[model samples]
Target: MPDATQDAAARILAAVRAIPRGQVAGYGEVARRAGLPGRARLAARVLSQNTDRTLPWHRVLRADGRIAFPEGSAGYREQCQRLRAEGVAVVDGRVRRELMAGAHGDLDAMVWGPPPR
Candidate 1:
């Protein structure tokens, strides 16, 4: 099972890496995209230990679009700043979905392109 676990981690990392700049996805959504449904917490755990700064860990949030950090904490402030730098509006501790809703709320479309016009 070690290999399976390692692969799962890899998949989760890949999913997180796939999040486009200026856009964000929920932890649950990231897990689902990694083919690990119902494992949002696992995704969060993996992220907490993430050392690769390029992974864009700030792009992952609760399903409600809120940053997971305490409202006034350093992490909260940093995440808000980083997200805003990417042009993702975080208003009232939650991302305004309309601003970041370009594509991929649907996993299939995220992997493949939208259906023919």
Candidate 2:
């Protein structure tokens, strides 16, 4: 019964869940991996709507490594808690990239496919 947008969002969430523990992906990255390039806002919207559970939603963050949830908000606290639980270092409500796992794809492979362009 899901609409096209909802189905797309679900696909994005599934991609997000594929992110291994201790790693994180930016909103834009999630969108791109979900086959919806330049749709970071849509990714965020989907995540927001499904925050009630069933997805590893906390693994998605802003491009600058900051938790997208606003500071002092319930979601922010939950995000920090979740990241910390996953061994992802969080300071000042932001993730420290050096302390977390790197992204999955390599430069050439990411842009040109695994076999190269």
Candidate achieving the largest TM-score: 1
TM-score of each prediction: 0.85, 0.79
Quick one: RMSD of model 1? 2.8
Candidate 1: where are CA atoms >4 Å away? 99-104, 107-112, 115-117
Cα misplacement distance, residue 42 of candidate 2 (Å):
0.3
Per-residue C-alpha lDDT of model 2 across residues 1-117, encoded as one tens digit per residue:
459887788779887887777777888878887889899899998888785676888888987889987799999999899988998889998887643223445222443565534
Give the lDDT of residue 23 in candidate 1. 77
Query: Least lDDT summed over 10 consecutive residues: which range in candidate 2?
Result: 99-108
Worst 10 residues of 1 by lDDT: 99-108
Clash count list over all predictions: 0, 0
**Candidate 2: Cα lDDT at 12:** 91
